[model samples]
Target: MLDMFRYNWQVRQDWFEWCRELPQERTGGMGSILATLFHVANGEQIWINSMQGTPVIVKEGVTSLEEAVEFTELTQSITEQFLQSWDDELAMKTLIKKRRDGSEITFTYDKIIKHLIAHEIHHIGQLSIWSREIGRKPVSSDLIFRDY
Candidate 1:
């Protein structure tokens, strides 16, 4: 399961490398690839902090693909360290999330991790479509072929 997170992060890394120079307009469409990427990175950081019983600090504004990749890598590194020391009991722990609208939601540690991975994947699909629409080939999405 954690492997899946790393794999998809690598795919996004590939996307960053592949479309590093894409104009902000193309990448920042309705969903805004950069914004979505920031969401994924920040989401990782936010959730990890939540799991550890700390304040969820969302450092926003990834202005470039390079920054997005770097932020993603940093968050993933912390996440890897956190997961490395995790146990089954930790997976069952719950984290309460407070939305901007003042609503609170709680999720189990394992569920938050799964949701973060799925969230990234959902946006990656959007990035894939954008990549091909611009005549650039998107990264292969097959897990079997993924070397991450």
Candidate 2:
């Protein structure tokens, strides 16, 4: 699973590089490239906050791709630190999250981390599709090619 995390980190780096080449006009606002990428990065931070008993800081307004990359780097650093303390006991520890409707759901740390990776990949696929529509070749998502 740690290897998977490393692989996803590399994938994210590639996606950010691909996004940097795109026009700034296409990277802002709702449903835009940077918006989606920011959401993925923010989601990672949210989960890390929950696990670490820290306050979730909400960042508002439009952000540049460079800023998004910086935020992602920060989130990844926090997550990596959290993972440094990972163990069988920590992996099995469960956390309950309350939804907007006041419903609660339970998940083990292992499952939550997996969901975080999958969530980002899912959004990255959307970026890839959008990239194609704009006549750009998107970054590769091939896992086998990754040396990680």
Indicate the worst ten consecutive residues by lDDT in candidate 1: 22-31
- Return the TM-score for candidate 2, rounded to 2 decimals: 0.89
Residue 142 in candidate 2, Cα distance off native in Å? 1.1
Residue 59 miss distance in model 2 (angstroms): 1.3
Error of 1 at 48 (Å): 1.3
lDDT of each: 0.77, 0.82
> For candidate 2, lDDT tens digit of each residue in 1-148?
6677777778888988887776664643346777887888888889989988898868973457778888988888888889889899999999899989999999999999989989877877887888888888988889998887
List, residue by residue over 1-148, the lDDT tens digit for candidate 1.
6788779878877777666666554644445767777787787788787787767666757777777777888888878888887678988988787889999988898888889878888888887888788777877777798877
- Provide the clashing-pair count of each candidate structure: 0, 0
Clashing residue pairs in candidate 1 (N, C-alpha, C atoms within 3 angstroms)? none
User: Of the candidates shown, which would achieve the greatest lDDT relative to the real structure?
Assistant: 2
Model 1: lDDT to the true structure: 0.77
